[model samples]
Target: MAYCYTASIFFPSSSSSSSILANDRLPHLAYRPAKIKRRLSFSCAALPFDLSPPPIDHDLLDTMTVAGAKVSEDGVIGTFDNDDEALDAVENGVAVVDLSHYGRIRVSGEDRVQFLHNQSTANFEILHEGQGCDTVFVTPTARTIDIAHAWIMKTAITLVVSPVTRERIIDMLKKYIFFADKVEIQDITQQTSLFVLIGPKSDQIMEALGLADIVEQPYGSHKHYSVNGMPITVGVGNLISEEGYSLLMSPAAAESVWKVLLGHGAIPMGSNAWETLRILQGRPAPDKELTDEYNVLEANLWNAVSLNKGCYKGQETISRLVTYDGIKQRLWGIRVSSPVEPGSTISVNGKKVGKVTSFTTGKRASQPLGLGYIKRKAASEGDSVIIGDDVEGTVVEVPFLARQIPPS
Candidate 1:
């Protein structure tokens, strides 16, 4: 059993540590935190960005959208036309999403692997050439610095990181350098174009785009190819779904790649569809859900946090939580009758127990689907919750009915 101190801190009642979820029992929770606590109110999404607008035609995107949501601070579209159109694109047609917001960092030098190995949760020492791994860089207290994907190229490691946490990630990674290490970090986000492709036909479409050799490669693995005499980097596996790849190419080649993908049955999807599917798969955007307010375990980032890995920035705190107090709450799926917004309060039997981190209406279903952290005692498979205005939501399994990929 554990007692909630403030929203983010917990103290265990017993010295014997129990596995997070075991013996068909809920972890005992006591002394819930009050709503007056301000620690949980910090939002990374509320921060400012000075990003240049993407090269895509904003006028055309604005005209196409009936309703819109921006994945970034700039005028990026979350959905073009409507959620239904984007949903149809994902399920039936190939969907292409502009991910210019995702930041890219190149870590190079002789000590690059060892340098990253000391900072992230994954074991980068074993990350071979052309291989990749999903990892997290965390604070000394184990709060998420960023959830990132490291693609180990022949001479350097490319870290594709969350948009909202981009600057912080780069700064911290650079700040932690010792004079002895030989790593050099470079931000290449502006020089490169990132596009995510999703659907059952995504692989086939990728093949048609001169990425056939890398289409079936696993997540984090990338291959450099020349398309139209321009260098392109193809990464297989979509972070949002079972089928897809992240295509990275120079800005000069973006238009050509976009046209090729669109011509080969890739439907343009805006931030709305991309976000809806992301929430459906229980993946939280750092801006919407990740902040110092939450830890990796509570964020449902089990895939990114490597408990067995050697010491890293936050290893001490992570090990302590996993072994002792455990997580008091965890991100869970919620189904509501109406659309619920992020920052929405979640109560169990009229007690404020959680907060909505990410939310959206089902594309075709048009009912509400969301992800939020619920107290351990309140987070059972069929538990129910009350959101704003008496709307009721049931705790459902994450991924809300979608194809699942192998955990990273």
Candidate 2:
């Protein structure tokens, strides 16, 4: 039986009917509106949404309700205790984070490989079953739509993307479908739950859970396992730590799996800790670094883009940027003296150079750290810059661990 689903696309609400076209900025490209505020809907065959698990109850844990601490938009706990304790758990021990908010889409049929290869930046044709690779979807002008990790399974390719971009990515994929192409796209997000184990002791915890083999697998590789009758697919990857593994399972098994991990000495981390960890790792977040405002190169996502691959959307723009050295700005790490808001300007010698995109207090250090896109010429590692007027900051390398002095 096929279930039908509808996704709504809402355009920007503005008084001006005039819209900016992509060709206006890049004359060689076909015209596409930069903004449209009308609400439109599309329908496709999908599994029942009811299959998704309900939001995790924070009351189940001895959570701390501090100011600025709350549930994430994705419905996961934002803070179990304090951010510092959470960071300590990740650095010195093991921590389990709920990532059920991430989206999962399954693409199947004989043409799946070729179709995905032409849709995203990664060379999907080279991925064999049980292997995975991170890929980015871009516009015709090479602007980022989203970054997804595709795991090749026996019957289909499972794409895990940020929750914010899930619907849009699915819509884009469906719109690109051709009548002669043998491809099927299904939203399996509701049917599955995703969680991550991070930190130095993550391997120990995995082994205790009877996933010793997964700890030895290379990044982007996964294996299936069953724990107490709950089927799980464990994948190796670095989400917020060098030692990290992701577990994907049915929604019905999520709670049990989470408890079992905690019972084995894994600290429960919430989004508050996640934000601090991600910023420290220099990993981009949805609607922050992974937006249309920046392209793949500017976002420093070269690892995810395959330069030698055949034509795909935005291939020309990416190639031109590389061939011409036209990347104006690049994402960088910043160590700030005090708290700063997103969109805070970064300047040097009284000149504006960049803007802070993501920031978090140093739960594991002395000051705040952030991610921003800076003009390549304006700053370099170890250089000092002004953030939002008089606040001073230093440009630093990402995975910002050098300055993480443990608090007294």
Candidate 3:
């Protein structure tokens, strides 16, 4: 059975003076529609075998036809209300987006910490309750496989992963289990909703929603609290450089949570908006920046790994690379003269030296910024690289935030 309601209500007219609350007196969680609501017949039950329904009200989203780009089978919005507004919200104001489309696994048992510590780039042994850290999973050859956020909680350590590598990571974890190490993996993505709030105003938005203030929390630390009568985990951290927060809640409460955030001035964004921000921030994404083609060293994820930590899978090669400075190509930012396609050849004079990985325009900087891997020999800070015929690009510092660094 599919639930539906009038499209107008979902994107209520800005001028309409009528309140959506039950009576303007009901608590946010207790409010029920005083008027009878209709549920139209529209089935969205069947989806691609490899995909899951986006943990959102597709019926309501479909009615929001004015904004957003293509709708994925999982109902992911490629863009919502134009990239410009989304960019503005994330760069200058508060923005919210559902990341339930990503993959997550719950790992438990006595050996959870040791098991993870052996497999990832980060030292998980130090993780205590309410702490989290960014880590990378590499193959025996030290090639990047996945980058995940490990959340230490009372019941389990939750590993949030990219949907592209969810199955592979699970298989790897299952394959390496020694049978007595005591570890279990459970996919919790379908049952939970992960919403990201970013921009400087993110903390204020959370406060407006009556959630615990996050400005005081240290980065990567998460805390649980009740909001709208729903229990949620709020993680304090940004994608890379800017201020950001992650809200984790049960799927049953997703719609209500989304509605409350939006009502409190949190702008709704989409994947395109997210991709643009990440690329500009020099953050790597699974299957793109995080792939077998590159290693953790080449990806410049220095914070994800610790040299003092002892042996684990692929530790030798990674250690050797660090000590010997064996990295060939490194991720860098490219300032383009014009919009260029991702994966377009980046060349010097006439020879190709690198390839564009991600690109975006209409940004806060009002420049066409991109990120890609450039060979150590060819890339130089502020040196221009050739594109097709007319387009050219100059190497720029990554994390593409204002604090600049010379290209290595």
Candidate 3 runs further than 4 Å off:
1-70, 238-242, 362-366, 388-390, 400-408
Clashing pairs in 2: 11-36, 11-37, 12-37
Candidate 3: the clashing residue pairs are 68-79
User: Which consecutive 10 residues in model 2 have the weakest lDDT in total?
Assistant: 20-29
| Tens digits of lDDT, candidate 2, 172-207 | 999999999999998877667788888888888665
**Residues forming the 10-long window of minimal summed lDDT in candidate 3:** 19-28
Model 1: per-residue Cα lDDT over 109-144, one tens digit each: 889898898898788887677677778777788776
Error of 3 at 20 (Å): 31
Give the range of the ten consecutive residues with the poorest summed lDDT in model 1.
19-28
Using Cα atoms with residue i matched to residue i, what is each candidate's TM-score against the true structure? 0.78, 0.80, 0.80
Per candidate, the number of residue pairs that clash is: 5, 3, 1
